[model samples]
Target: MAEKAIAALTEAQASEELARLAHELARADQAYHGDDAPVLSDAEYDRLKRRNAEIEARFPALRRDDSPSDRVGAAPSEGFAKVRHAIRMMSLSNAFSDEELQDFDKGVRRYLGLGADEPLSYTAEPKIDGLSLSLRYENGRLVQAATRGDGAVGENVTANALMIDDIPDRIDGAPDLLEVRGEVYMSHADFEALNLRQAEKSARTFANPRNAAAGSLRQLDPEVTRGRPLKYFAYSWGALSARLADTQMAAIERLSKLGFRTNPLTKVVEDVDAMLRHYAEIEAQRATLGYDIDGVVYKVNAIDLQDRLGFRSTTPRWAIAHKFPAELAWTWLDGIDVQVGRTGALSPVARLRPVTVGGVVVSNATLHNEDYIAGRDAKGEPIRDGKDIRVGDFVQVYRAGDVIPKIADVDLERRPKDAQPFEFPHLCPQCGSDAIREPGDSVRRCSDGLICPAQAVERLKHFVSRAAFDIDGLGAKQVEQFYADGWIAEPADIFTLEERFGSGMQQLKNREGWGEKSAENLFRSIRERRRIPLGRLIFALGIRHVGEQASLLLARTYGTWEAFETAMVDAALMEGPAWDAILAIDGVGRVLAQSLVATMNQDAERAVIDRLVALLEIEEAEAPYVADSPVANKTIVFTGTLERMTRAEAKARAEALGAKVSGSVSSKTDIVVAGPGAGSKEKKARDLGLTVLDEDAWLDLVGR
Candidate 1:
């Protein structure tokens, strides 16, 4: 129901809704945490609980049984080698009940040598049930991030951390060094959606949102982590260049100003009673919150006092985690389906008979991968009780603090006679292309290059996407329609539409769903995209390995399309300086370079490129804009680099910050970095009166 409708409900109506909500929520909880499979998605359950909360908030006295105020916590998850933390990340003491919380408060007061009547402020906030992370920012830029592995040591997750949209790539006006501590968690909605996608492709689905977040952050491929819907909440600081604030709440507020999403419920309470009240309030609000939290955390507000209170062997003496008890349920696994992703990875999704759990209906879950379907691990070892999930199997599903609805277990005794093992297609279902799984890779991929209809359509979609050509009146539908009609087979065909069909015996205006004005508008939209940046054009090509960032890197390195095309053609001929040049482009490695050259080597691809080039005026990529840098957007040269870094390293570093690093020092050269050898290029720079920097000076200039 709409919020307005729910709000306008009479007290009697609300009371009746609450009663139903109580029963439904109870069932959902049992299914999510019990021996039975869950019947509700995390989002569905959260919405129902949120609805219950909204109604209860409006009519507190009319609240029914099984309210969120009585709920509790569950157990918590992933990959990678370990990196020791600079400082130990201590855990918090646990307080399961109000009496425990009070005792913890008393312990804090007694330790601090404060009288029983004296006021001792504490910051109470929701303890998100996800991975703990420590982000180290150097000179206002994120440098490293790590997972809390063993308090004293953790796995480096810097690459994955950078992928988080919530974490800033670069912060303005920050300290020289800052170590921000926070939780990286997935929301209920994102978790459910993620699981559905996972199940659709027959991939390994996460048991809960916590596992999803943890696994995402620990992925060896940062690109994989980038795809996950992970979020960060900065609650505290481990190290800082300067003091953030005197109080914990104020420090969190400062982090908020620095672009961190801090919990809104954090408050400075005056006494133990306020802390308990806040905890109860937060618990009631948990179902409505998008993220999963086991309980409310309370810490000494004063930073100085926190330091004085010190830590125990494992947990901090000044902080405590007051947990709520956890919530599971039984559901039927009806069937399984597959879904292909943008790059063509298949995932398996579970189709379930609709069941009520936690007061909401769950009709689906994730089956994960082919191995999961066959009841085996990645190595084909027996798992899941050595029984494959059948179509009519009774699966145990659960939703903990995390909102993802997952199959905890499957009972095969009730397997239907019609049940059969799912056969994963070796060919892409959408394009008839061979879907191959490479060695050391878990996911399979479509190998049709740009020929597959699915890949082509997806490419066309990207070509006209907002970040690419962004042609108006030519969305995905129009592109697909045009493609199916054999009117626009490639990017260039889009530009040829007006000339070919603007006014003819078979005009676009004559077609169904097309009018004279609309057809003209479509042509106009295509015409507007005739001139685009080289980077955007490269990105629109939809090469297998190249992404937006990689496209931009190539564009910046070559500056012009002609230079880039020539280099690529040369590289395709044989491995030499040209291939090395492509590989030398910081982010571009041998594999990516090979993928790019392979695309260019195809005759059909080259012909398409020729047609596209003939139709448009491609602009040179703009130089990197390092606003505060001395060499940004400037043409420069490096000569006689005798120490510190290799010549290629210097070129990559300079080009990354928008400097044009040329092979030779010429009249156009803005500056020349001259090392101890003092070569002829250095002399030329002096003759030209261009600025010359020594190796040491150059290093200092870039903050290296």
Candidate 2:
């Protein structure tokens, strides 16, 4: 509502908007300045201010007395001594495009009485997304430190600042009184580590680096502040008795020499094009960089030029902070719903008021688990600053790398009065089973086994999925429809569809969307898959921890269904060679072995499997790898054509045994398998001192 353009508003509409903006901005000011925890993202606050300015420009009389246009930010929070800065630490105007940057340059020229042809210089530095602080040094010793609250007055944090290792305690060749201004921030690695520690202690986890830094810095206990990993980057100074240098870049260099950390990306550029190019380069490296940066800040390089093109009411005329397009968006959370998985874990999803984020329309976001919804940890400790999301709360949703949706923060002030807490059900919604969460596990599971509709449906879907049976005419919608209409209940029932309904009085062809042709085609596809390979049959069973690789291992270990069943029966006795052999497969663990055996021993499950087996042909499994094979698990370079099998057959055979076949030979190549007419690859293999084997030798080793 706040981001709507001014040109789209009527006079009456503008008046209402002004009132709303005044109230929201005032609340945001209180949260940001007083709490040290901002409810709104900076981009969102900026957009609201921009909208207010635009509305006032279009309808001047509609502006209220409490308009946010006249204010810089909310007043300083209580508890710390207030320091009045000698020079006000002001914010910067924003430039989102190259044209805005070009306009900025043009405006500088007009103010300096210079023409477009003038060779003006500028300096660009990364605008670190962090808390702004000013450190005061007197008589070459650290004295005071304060935050940039409301631009003029700030809270003194000398004790907290003293704990930061990056701040110099004393300097020898310095001014009588020097005030160094910079950002105090936490790096990405530190933030992740902090979150892990928070999880262990059942404390609240921070949303991002900026929040972590701010929260750490504002702690009443200096001991808590001392424990946090904090760093500083000195960019611009506040008040200095002795001048460092004439130009911006030179001043930064001097600061570096004085043992202050400076951003290495800062550089002096000749024109606007260079500034844009630098911004692009920084944006490209944003994700890989250890710390967070909102944008690039550009300033007139020369001190004289900056003085000449001096202050606007709240910002400098000669500089601008070019912000990145927002990855985070504010939208109303509409409702919370639950989805039961094949593993019977009930996952909650937040249905949101549809909003476009980074070009994608996102309407649903994950709530993670019940603990996330209740603002607690595994032990029911508070988290996310103790903010529990209600249905009507306006929440900040961000996309990491523009793909994953995460709820960043909640605006508690905007939450409706009637909103209630989401009740994470103790009983399974899909089945009347007792939903149990074992100690130390995050997910709640249904104990009803195959009786649960959702779990059974999902298992059936997985059974016919592409990696399993992969019937041609079967898809998600068809499977869902068949499950709902009682046409299929288990994997075995699929084969009986034609015998039960084909050319009968109560026929499937009489259905609305499915006709004779479609039904016949579907039955034909089902018939084609009656003879499935061993690996596919094992995976289609959907036993816990039994994935494609584990299934392959089981299939290859026992050649036939009868042999596999007998081995599993014997393994269930708890002491046998059959269990040892199952565990001996390279990738198979005790958990998977137990799961497979337990699944096969269940009376109902075994009955289903027997019925399915009776209706189809189950092929014998083949073992491709043996311990005595010469090339077992070796990486081989296949160079030239073979006199016997084709190159494809050779590659397939090698891959089946866990051997990696490469097109080129390197130091890591164990051996080179060469054919009659060898090429440069064989030469390179010999040059690298790798063993070369002839086709006949390879064939003899594999018993071909």
Candidate 3:
């Protein structure tokens, strides 16, 4: 009786422990993947996962319903519309080691009841480090595109998808409804080019290609998406209305026939050994591939067999992703230096002996922050030489999935005997201003904002950026030339280009690479951009945290340049409900507001603004509708036909008089301005207890 009770208690206790462990593991996974900041190390997370797996195996009869061991990833994001896949595109289970790969292969063979003599064909392809998208075509025309959100419901990105060059507008011999799954990747060359351009323009550089591609695709404006260079390669498929072929190779052939560019490296192998050989070949030549690939993905060639094998909750039993070993190399850490950003964050960068890795010469790598430099190792000793990196110490650098090289380990034995630990400066190297590190942040920042020469040059470049002033023929080199020649110094100086060099224009025409035609083109381009859009003007001002999206939001909200300028100045001078009103703009946060105030208060900035106002024709400020006013403050949801005004003109006029014109209506909507053929927004506004106003009423309220 005692033994039976003990056994029962043990089983119940084991089950409870397993459930608790599973929850913890899932939360950790979410933190790692969703946040990109993992709380646990790889070893610690692996240990916890192994323990949970063991518990689940022991108490099979008492398994929890929501186990981390069972779940693949988080459910689909909520913001996007749901798209149920007819044929689910399952993720692959990963193997970090050759032993693990062998075990995975053995398990697959055993599960399929395959004998030693039985042949198994597999196809291996590169696992791209990019966002997974599913493109659906109906009767040869592209219809929908969705993201791989939780391997299920995905964000509808049809507008952005249309901009991708590789995605065919129409396909030949396609089914009524066919879904082709692929990776939207930014090539390494394009990534480098973009980063160079961003650096020249003093814009925020993306950490990696995957991030750049993802951010570009999520842009609200399809036009903005069209500007980014994005490419795609169809690797798999889902939701087929008509069958293509029996084998995976045949299906790929069919897709190619339908005008899709399938990866040419994909090949049918006779056995697992052949698959491994193909993976090795690919891995060996990965650097020359010109794109970032994290691993090799192998899947069974026969579609019918794959279906029979079925899938687990998140991964298919027939497919596995074998990751390459982290690309690591030893380099001599010669020295360390601090570089200041526009925001004044001082970052420690490791200066190393140049080494070629992934087809690129790497001479410098980010050290992250001081804490990372001084962090302790497994032996409870500081990782860096003498609590920080020394002038001459051998360091191991690693690049995983095209991630920026990071110092992995220090070879103290290889350290030069005379080498000394480097000292960090407390003053800004560029401006000699005192650098200060905030309480929580690891970075030390220069106090000089606009005054720092480096910062000023950077800000000036940002002013004439493509998304800002977009001065044609004024590339980075030209900007540098103008700055060096003392022809232009500030953002406002650009407006006085022709005036400053009116008589000397002939000299510009005679200058090397600047013929009469080029000079005329340059002047014409500058003149053409004088009457700039509100968003472009706002972005050109170089306000901190005000990116292209924020600039558009502020422009749409304010409607006119004067209104925005007045709001910014008012917010800068006063601190109360009026200041709160400025912050109330959808995307304007405290950091942005503070930066704006700081910029406005600077004498140098005020001079630039004054010069700009004098040189350029400033548009008259429009009256924006107020929320409290019966006519002025109403939340108007515009829809239908407007014969008199363009849609843009209508929205601008409505916003000018302090009216909030929303894209969609809610219970808070004051009026629905319907035009000739009022659509869904108009109908929804009426249903949501809001007043419906026609175009005549909208025009009358604006006094048009």
lDDT scores of the candidates, listed in order: 0.73, 0.76, 0.68
Please give, for residues 314-366, the per-residue lDDT of candidate 2 as tens digits. 57777898888767789999998887767677777789998766434567776
Error of 2 at 641 (Å): 88
In angstroms, the error of model 2 at 490 is 70
Model 3 agreement with the true structure over 214-302: per-residue lDDT tens digits: 77776668897898889898877888887788888888888888877788888898876787888899999887998878778888888
Segments in model 3 whose C-alpha atoms lie over 4 Å from true places? 1-126, 129-171, 175-232, 235-292, 295-326, 335-337, 369-387, 401-403, 438-441, 503-513, 601-603, 617-704
Regarding TM-score, does 2 or 3 come out ahead? 3
By lDDT rank, best first, the candidates go 2, 1, 3
In model 2, the worst 10-residue window by lDDT is 1-10
- The candidate, 1 or 3, that scores higher on TM-score is 3
TM-score for all models, in order of appearance: 0.50, 0.48, 0.51
Superposed model 2: Cα runs more than 4 Å off: 1-5, 8-12, 56-69, 328-332, 335-704
Residue-pair clashes, model 2: 0
lDDT, model 1: 0.73
Q: What is the per-residue lDDT of model 1 for residues 460-538, given as tens digits with 9 covering 90 to 100?
A: 8867864468787887898888899898878888887767765431557778888877876777777778999999888
Question: Over 4 Å off in model 1, which ranges?
Answer: 1-264, 267-335, 338-369, 382-390, 395-409, 427-451, 503-517, 633-704
